[model samples]
Each structure stands twice: as C-alpha cells, then as structure tokens.
Target: MQIQEKIAVVGGGSWATALVKILSENGAEVNWWLRSPEDVAHLQQYAHNPRYLSGVRFDLDYVKPSTDLAETVAKADWVILAVPAAFVQQALTPLAQDAFKGKTLVSAVKGMIPVQNILITDYLGEQYGVPAEHQCVIAGPCHAEEVALEKQSYLTIGSHDIVRAEQFCRLLRNRYVKANPLDDIDGVEYCAVLKNIIALACGIAHGLNYGDNFQAVMVSNAMTEIEDFLHAIMPLPRNLTGSAYLGDLLVTAYSQFSRNRTFGNMIGRGYTVKSAQFEMNMVAEGYYAVQSIYELNKRLQVDMPITTAVYHILYERFSPALEIDILKDKFK
Candidate 1:
C-alpha cells in the first residue's frame, strides 16, 4: 500500500472520519479539516475522533488534522466534501472561487442544495466553475459505521470521466471494501437523494406499525416513483437495480443504523420534527432532501406519491398517520 496521493477530506463527521481512516490506512497522505478546534486537538493527540467513530484510531504520520480550509485544500490532489448539504455553502465560504481549479472534487454527500434543488456537482460547476469531468460522487450501499467495523462494504464512484473514476476507485478498494466506477453520475447522485426520502417513508411506515409486507409494497412502489422522477429530470438510461440505486435504497430504509429512518420513526411515533431533530442531534439528509425534491417537482410535475407524502407530513404539518393511510391507497 505504497500510495503517494495527497487527499483533503473536509468535515469532521463520521463519514469524514471513515474516509480519512481508509485513505490513510491505504498509505495516502490525508489533510483533514474539522470545524471545531477541540476535535482537531483530540484527533491530533488521541489519534481518534472524540465525537465520531472514536474506536478507530489513525496513524498521525499519514493524517494531518487542521482547521484552516484553504491550507487543507491547497495541499491535496483530491478534495472530498463529506459535510451535510445544509452547511456546505457555509463550510466552503472561506475559499476563493478558483481554489478547486485543478483538484478532483468528490462529493460524499447524499443531498441537494436545500432551496436551489441542485446536485452537489451542479452547484460546484455553477459556483466554482468545476467541470463535470473533474467532479465525482461517492454513492453507497456502504455506511460509515460498517466501514469502521471492517464489515464488507461496496461503493460506487459516479463520474462523467469513467477513467478518472476508476483511478479514484483504486485508492478506495481493500479487503473489506469493493469500489466500482459508474458513468451515470447524474443518475447515481439523484438516486442517492431520492433513496433517502424513500427511507424516511419506510421509517414512517414502520413507526405506524405497518409490517414488512406493507413496507415491501411501499419499497416496490417507491422504485417506480424514483424511475419516473429520474426520467422526468435527467432522462438517462440507467439500471436502477444496481448497488448505487436500489441497494442503497434498501439499506437506508431497513438498516437499524439509518438516522433518517430513526428520524421518521420518531415523527410517526408522535414526536414533532423539531423534537426529533433535537433528540437525535444529527442531520438526517432526507429531512432536507424531501423539501428540495418536493419543491423541484412543482415544476417537473412528476407523480411522486412517496415523496409527496413525506413532504406533506414533514413540511405541511399533516398528521403522519393520516399521510401514511392516504399513501397506502396510492401504493399497489
């Protein structure tokens, strides 16, 4: 594992920590950025993140923890954005527009711009002038928790440049992890966003005590809903049954580790949105994603019953029980 790639991983969350662990363990130099000074100090001293995946220790010689955004991005050949979508703008505000000019940007975020409703790659292209070929997205049936536990996991690197994607994939693959490249960047990214919404819907159903049989119908109907929406927006030919699309959807919907499902279950079990968010203390990307997708659909006019049902319950203050019951009639 004698690699010479210098990577910059932005954000201090579990996913960011996990990426740093993988890359550094594989012998790449990682310039890690964290918002909090205390977390940086903790990682530098303890060789582990105090707040996230603390059990996994890092080799400090390969990991350089820092708080300076510009310096972190300046030294890396590749920059991975692992921050939540809601704070993406704020997180990168300190850097100049041309900061990412020659660097390969990888988005590990499974969300869209909240109100603008654009993908991360789109936003990077528009705001920073990064081209489609220079950008990549990390899609998963893979979760950070599993990565920390050394459980077998699979990841899809979606990019317009398949060669570049494959090159990047080599940096990720190891015994417990398998990385593959996909040419359908837009399709993969959009599926990542939509699946979170589906997970929330599934969580809500589970919270309502709807059994596996009912959820099976919901997931099946959701696959159709996703197909229609992707066609309406991107109009690309893609296999939704791939690991990046349906596998990711199924995992997020059913995994006990899904924060989105936990959030939805709380909402279904009589907790308000605010209360659930407060209690969990983590960002469930689906909560923000549902709103963006819902608002975007107003113009696209796609028939997304699951997304619509989620938006109604989360945004419009519709009763969860009422929404789920109504959603039941729409599903086959």
Candidate 2:
C-alpha cells in the first residue's frame, strides 16, 4: 500500500468548505483546521457546515475537521491557508512553533495587511518566518461562490519556483477548475486585493441603478487605476485588462455571490460598514482591505480614486451620492 500526501485546509469558512470539496474530488487526504473545538465537534458530529457554507456537507471519510492545528498540518504535504486576510497571521502564528515544518504553504487570501501594507504572502515571509520560496500565492479571478457550485474557475498559482507552482496546480486542478501557473507572485496578489476595492465601487454604481454602459466605463477606469497601482508596487506588466484582472473584477463587482458587492449594496441602501458586517456574519474582504488601500494611497501619493471614494463613503460621512458624482468626474 502507498501513502498519499495529506492536504490540510486552514479555516472553516465558506471558501474553506468549498475548497475541501474540490480537494476531496482531487483525491487528496484533507484535514480541515476548524476555528475552534466547538466547530470541530459540531461538524464532526453532524457532518454539515451550518454556520458558513450551509446546505453543503463534507464526506468525512478522507476529510477530518479538527481544531488542533498541529494535528491538522502535522504530516500534510501541502497546507492551504483559507482564512480571511485579516486573520491570516493569527491563524498561522500558533502553528509557527513546530508544526508545518518543511511543508509547502499556499495562500488563498487576497486582502493586504493594514500595518505592513503588503500581501499575505509578503507578510508570511517578512513577519511569519516562512521561507519565501516555500510560499505560493494562488490567485486570479476565483471566487468561493463559483467553487461552491463546483463550477469551472481558473486560478494562477504563482511562485518564484515554476516547478512547485505546477506541482501544486496538479494537486488543485480539476474538471471545474483549471490551475494555471505564473511567475509574478506580487503582481497577482496586488490585483486580487485591489479588484475587491474596484468591485465595491462598481457595486455602489449598480445598487444606485446605474446602467451597464455606465458600469462599463467605471470598471474600465478602475482597471486603469489598478494597472497603475500594480506597476507601482511590482514591476509586473500592467495588462490588467485581461481575464485574471477584469474577469475577477466582474465577479466581485457585479455578481450576487460577491460578499463585497453585497456589502456595497447594503451600504448603498443605507447601512453602515459595521452594521453591514454584523448582518452578513461572513468576512467581506473588501471591508477589512479598505483600511490598507486607503493608507497606501495617502502614503504613495497615488490616486486610487475608487478606493478613496469608498473610504469617504465608509468612514468620513461623505454621502454615497456625492462620492459617486466625484468618482464619475475623475474618469471624465
């Protein structure tokens, strides 16, 4: 008998639940690190995800949801970090002592760290003691909503090591999922985070009943800003007008499945940021990411007009109506 490499999924959220489903389909042994003992016991006892990805059930045979981080990643060959970017450091810190030793680490979180103003991978390497080459950033136009449906979605598994990127892609690729490889880790991560902010702006336009033509222009202008922003951070090319960039922005900005878009709709309908979060009971990456981008724009002296508008609407008591008009003017 041969032993297969184990894959541990860190986080018990919707995205984790969905990825577990896909990883199981990929024929890998999965250990899901639950948020707490209570979550582990509840799912272990009921075999269902009641809190986050409701209506989806995990097959417990090769999948074990546990609260023990050490036990989850102990012998796993590949560990996927699926927690919100806000919680990535905290989640990985407890295991930093001895667990995950010599294991490949992959990140699915898109938002940036507020203090460091860097992507999760950068923070992982700079602050978390993970070897830079061992870190792989899985990015692109992927949304958990599509994964939950077992629908086809493409991802760019980016790393400095092309061989490792392709290896992980082989582990993650599936019928409904295509894993493409990329050499630009920072560029992909930046696009992933900024696209969320861009989408929040588009969602506001949509909730205000702005038509498609208006949104097309808004998204185009936002992408241009994103291209400029990406080039400023990483020397990667700024052809963000493509699928990985535009495709993701479309789903995040327009889809009903986007939590950020949903958050935007609520805000456009007269809900505060805090209230919107409490109502959703799920992590809207954009809500947490806005703080980082707002500070970045101020520090870099770069004009991320959309993020600035969202920051005003969210914190400064600027009317969404006024913000919308001001944003529209920037493109013209």
User: Which one wins on TM-score?
Assistant: 1
lDDT of 1 by residue, 1-332 (tens): 96889999999999999999899999999999999999999988999999999999999999999999999999999999999999999999999999998999999999998888899999999999999999999999988999999999999999999999999999999889999999999999999999999999999989999999998899999999999999999998888999999999999999998999989999889899999999999999999999999999999999999999999999999999999999888978
Alpha-carbon lDDT of model 2? 0.79
RMSD of each: 0.6, 2.1
Model 1 lDDT, residue 326, Cα: 94
* TM-scores, one per candidate: 0.99, 0.94
Q: Local error of candidate 1 at 142, Å?
A: 0.6
lDDT of 2 at 155: 83
Give the runs in model 1 whose Cα sits over 4 Å from its true position.
none
